[model samples]
Target chain A: MKIGVIAYRGGNVRSICSALESLGVELLYTAEWEQLRGCAGLIFPGVGAALPAVQDLQRTCLWEKLPTWDRPFLGVCLGMQLLGKESEEGPAPGLGVFSYAVRPFREAPRVIHMGWNAVSPLMQDPLWYGIESPFYVYFVHGYRADVMDCTIAEAVYGERFSAAVRRENFWGVQFHPEKSGEVGFKVLQNFLSICKSYQP
Target chain B: MLAKRIIPCLDVHEGRVVKGIHFQGLREMGDPLSLGLRYEELGADELVYLDISASVEGRKTFLTAVERIASRLRIPFTVGGGVREVADIRALLEAGADKVSLNTAAILRPLLIEEGAALFGRQCIVLAIDVQKEAPALYRVYSHGGRIATDWEVVLWCKEGINRGAGEILLTAIGQDGTRSGFDVQLIRSITSWAKVPVIASGGAGALHHFLEVFREGGADAALAAGLFHEGVLTPYEVKLYLHQYQIPVRL
Candidate 1:
């Protein structure tokens, strides 16, 4: 599979790319968004605050290029938030792919929800194939991606919130597959498989 | 729900696991690789290894120990003590340590934290503070393994640490360390009150209830204990079960 991952500052996208390499997947760093000619899927991952990440994407022209790619796209954490209209973290508008806004935890417990979280999978699709129920995936974020109807799976942190979102040809997860253990590895592996066999 | 964390801290000296009181004595506890593997089976959420030895000569030694553990262990591990520059941080990463902690080196060079984060990413850098309460409501930062005093207050360094690219703050109250009395609740409340990153309250964790008090009452993100974990008085899996019974989130 030909996979393209967006490289944002402070992100371990490279690690995820490395892991993908183990699956015999071909990966490309599309930080500049100039070369997307033959990519099968795109993985968008970011660390740090929301506004600055969006600004960096805009500077690299990836902000404008990602949405219209007509290919499978995956966003991790801040990358998932950037798919929304606006995040409470800043002035930079989200990609507006998902009809939602990033909202801060009004009465949330910690600033960053580090460590692993219990993932309750949904049966809407088979993306979670071979993965066990009540799986644990690493999470680190303050603001969560609040979507209208795109949410597919949910994770409980203070309250049950959207953990993964799947739109037509677009999927975003609030956790880091690169840092998440074996289950995380599965998420990336499944995405590569989906991109390879995507009918659209 | 936000889960409470149980961390087993290993004090490394001359590239071996050692245990001591007030950061002295330094008797060999056990092999770090074995202890790390055992802690994982015990269901420890995380593991931390404090070099505890801050001498210039100690860095080379700890790297060998860290490299061995990182290759063998499957769980998350943090290595601290004597990490000075961005290159030092890189070396630790190359050695296979999951995270590199900064103490005296970070205080001496603040920008080194940002540089390390830029090089290795923020999630890999841990900023540790050794603090002692000299006056009421005032905890001063101590360098040289809690001996020398820096005018910077504990909270100040914590805020600075997160801003300068530290993902978590390993705050140990020297007054409460090794006492097995309990954590400094006020100190826990203060450090966790404003720190943006995850705060692992270390130094004094005598019982499971102590861990509970820190997280529930003190609002700490994680609780770490070296003596209790090493002595086998309190196991991480048992604590997780107890906390889960009380409606606290912990990995089970």
Candidate 2:
């Protein structure tokens, strides 16, 4: 099955493509809606601030189209933050695909909660398939999404925050699965399987 | 709680993993990709790939090797050496490097740090400072792979880099780089106390106690080593297990 990775400005498209390709999945790197329509699944990989990133999506007219897309969609890092109603990073409005707000960490020992940390599953879900609790994942971000009803996994640094949130066909993870070692690879594999079995 | 990081630094010259004593008398270890994979399997928290000859030879980083190795690993990989501009940083990130370390380039043009951090997030920009003691208890920053001394003081330069947009600092103690005596605990402690960003202590790791000392006494968020790991002196797994046994938080 083909997966279209949204070619948003300033995001690490190459690493995301490399990770997906390593899993034997074909990728379509494009911002054009027509090209994205041909893929069975979509991934919105991000790295930069919310203002310019959201502006880029709006410029390409992809922002308005995301909510209605009936496919398995995964958002990584900044992409996940953009799924929220808004972000404190830019105080910018996001896609509002999920009813939550992304806020910056206030009480962490370090502002950018980087390095390897453990994530616990909040409930039984396919994203946690074959994955044990307290698994290590790589996280690097100053902003975090609040724990909502859609949160499937949660992690605590200075305080509890949503690590992974799923709603219907949408999935958003705050960590970089591509860079989080063996267990991280398993997360990608699980996402691919979910996409393959997804019926639209 | 966040676990302390154990990083293995691989010095690569001409696509081969090499190690040197005080940045001289190079010896080949193995291929970069294989060594990196081995270290990851052996429980290295992170991997650093520095192109030792890139700046000296006035060439760009070996992106071909970096891309190949990065595609095969899941841990965060940092690539450094000969990174001079924002375009170079972009290219390295496109080649699958998770972070790009800036040393000489950042010293030459301090604005490069701001530009890089603006284009990509600050998380991907690592300011690598090579330092050596100039006088009694006075440390100075070195450029060109620790060959030339700069006017900037170590603490002042690190603070400036952070203020200008560097997310992390990879501080290398030139005096202790390959000596395997121990980390520059005084240097590390002072910097970690002042700098707002996370500090990865590099150079001078001999026994497992050095790792313990760096974390406990030195206050380093991570500890990096090369010579010992290259010469089969210590494995990443053994060091991490030792840290865990001593009640230090490390991913086992």
Candidate 3:
């Protein structure tokens, strides 16, 4: 199946593409919605601030089309933050695909949480098909999404925050699966399987 | 809680991993991509590739190496060395470097940190400080590969760099480097006490206990070692296991 990675003009999209190529999957990296529409699944990979990413998405009209897109989707790092209703990093609104609001990490020993951390899965899903609780993954961000109803996995630095969240076909993860080693690669492979089995 | 990071730094010169004694007498190790892939397999939390060459041709070779490493490696990696202007930072990041480490350039032009943070976000910039102890609990920053000493004090420069938008600090002790005795815990404690970002303690990692000492006593968020990992003396996975036994949180 063909997968399209949304080009929001920022983040390590190259690494994501590289990871997918290693998995031997056919993929398309494009900024145009026309090209993405033909793919079976979509992956929104991003890094950097929320303001510019939101601005770029709005400029390309992907910001409006993504929330309504009826296909298996995944968002990574800042892309996960963009799925929230709004962000503390900026004075703008997110896609509101999920129920949480992105807020800056406060009361933490360090402002930016950068390094490896354990993720605890709260419920069963295809994303955690072979994963166990308290698995380690690489994380780097100053802002975090609070644990809410849609949160599937949670991790703690200074406080418990959403590690992975899902609602219907939308999946958002705060960690970089492409950069998380073996377990991370397993997560990607599971996502691909989800896309292959997706009826839409 | 966030697990303490075990970063294996690869000092690259003209696109090849090199070994040195106190930043002199360079000798080749092996290909950077192969070493990096192995480290990732061995459970390295992250990797840092410092391009130590000074020539323009060396810089080009480093970028090509970065591309090759970025394409295959599944884990995050950083690139440094001779990153001067905003354009250079852009080139490294565009080449797929997760973060760009700035040492002398950030000190010479503090505004580079602000500009890089503003353009790419603060987390993309890392302020690397080479330090030398002046006296008990007294340290001074060094520049030009520790050949020249600067007036900026260790703790003060760390705070200044953070204020200028450096998300993390890679503190390396010049005196302890290549000695393989132990880390300068006192120096690291001084910086980690007040500095807001994560502190990566580099230099003087000899045995398994040093990693535990830095994390438990020194309060370092991460520990970095070059020769110990490069020469097959220690591996990141073994160190993490040792740290875990000592009740130190590390990715296993």
Candidate 4:
């Protein structure tokens, strides 16, 4: 399948892209998205801070494209936060696809929820694939999304927040599957299947 | 309850894992890949591979090495060294690196942070700052692999990294590196207080208590150690046990 990634500044999604390549995907970058029109899927991975990253998206007009993309979109970590109503970290606005608020972990074990934790699907979310029980995905973030709708998946950090959210064609994971090992790889594979069956 | 992260950094040069004091006293320790896998099994929350060597052509080799490691690693891994442009970030991600870290490149081209954050999402971009106590009262940011010192205040640049789309700030105390004493508490706290983003405290982790100290007094969201974890001085699992004793939340 043909896949596209947004490698803006230092995306470094080698862990994920390599996994997808192992599954026979032809990966393209943000600058090469034009050639991905007929591609099979799209993934938005994160690496660094938030405000400036969104600013660059606006600079390249991608800030507008995120909410409107028709392909099967998978957002990881900050990628998922961008789909929220807004982020408290900076002045940049979010894509606002999910009815959620992305805010920092105020009082928990502390900020920067880092490590592998149990993720339970609220129901049988498609991204869970065929996992037997709650799976563990690697997560590293200070801010998490608070969605009004029942969260698709949740991980107990200081408190429970949305670990993964879904509305129609959009899927967002707060953890790093590319880094999460087997369960994470399953997430990508599931996302690929979703894209394959997407009408849009 | 958010799980506090424990990270380990390995200095990879010429495709081998090396450690030293001040990031210069280079000594061959073990195979980078073997050490990387060991850390993952040891329950390291995340792993960072900093390429201290500044070879332009070796950039591809670095990516290849990271891919080799990522193929076996199921945890998050960040690679940094000579990453300079947006395309470099793309190549690294495509090669299987979970995250790409920018130190020299971000300092040289500050705008690259935005491009990286926006396209891939800010969480994948790491802004690693090398800091040194410039004066009795202030710590200054050092770039160009910590050789050239810019007037940029470490605290100020940390805030800039967040504004530019970096999700994590890796604060490495240049003077404290490999000292195993502990992290620069004052520097770590200064940036953590100003920036809401997650900060990884690096450098000067000599004893296991040093990790707890940085997490407590330094106000770091995460603690990263090298020599101690490398030389059998400390293990991530043992540190978690200690953090649990202190009532600091950690993944067991």
Residues A1-200 of candidate 4 have per-residue lDDT tens digits of 67888766545566666778877778886644456455677788876667877877777756776677788888888888888888887845788888687888766653457667778788787787787567767787878887457478887776788999988778888988877756777888888888777785
| Structural RMSD, model 1 | 4.5
Q: Write candidate 1's Cα lDDT for B1-252 as tens digits.
A: 556778889988767789876665678877778888798778887789878666666768788777777655545678887777777777777676667889998899899899987666677788989999988989999998888999899888888888888888888899899899999989889977777678889988888788788889888888898889888898999888888888887777
Worst 10 residues of 2 chain A by lDDT: A8-17
Clashes of 2: 1
DockQ of each: 0.18, 0.71, 0.85, 0.30
| Top candidate, metric TM-score | 3
TM-score chain B for all models.
0.94, 0.95, 0.98, 0.94
Per-residue lDDT tens digits for candidate 4, residues B1-252, read: 445678888887777778775556789887767888888788787898987665755555677788788777777788888888999888877777767899988888899999998787676788999998978778988887688999789878887888888878898899998677778899888887767577889889888788788888888878888878888887998998899899887766
Report the C-alpha lDDT of model 2 over A1-78, residue by residue, as the tens digit: 899999977876666678899899998999999989888899999887889898889897799898888989999999
Superior by TM-score: candidate 1 or candidate 2: 2
| Model 4, docking class | acceptable
Q: After superposing candidate 3 on the true structure, give the runs of residues whose Cα lies further than 4 Å from its correct spot.
A: none
Q: Residue B147 deviation, candidate 2, in Å?
A: 2.6
Q: Candidate 4: how many backbone clashes? A: 38
Model 1 misplacement above 4 A: A1-3, A18-40, A49-65, A86-90, A118-123, A130-136, A156-161, B12-42, B51-79, B85-100, B105-126, B133-140, B150-167, B179-181, B193-197, B230-235
> For residues A1-113, what per-residue lDDT tens digits would candidate 3 score against the true structure?
89999987666688889999889889998889999999889999978778888888889878889999898999999889999999988766899999799898887888898
Tell me candidate 2's TM-score on chain B: 0.95
Rank order (by DockQ, best first): 3, 2, 4, 1
Cα lDDT, model 3, residue A8: 74
Error of 1 at A38 (Å): 4.7
Error of 2 at B78 (Å): 1.1
Top candidate, metric DockQ: 3
Model 1 Cα displacement at B161 (Å)? 6.0
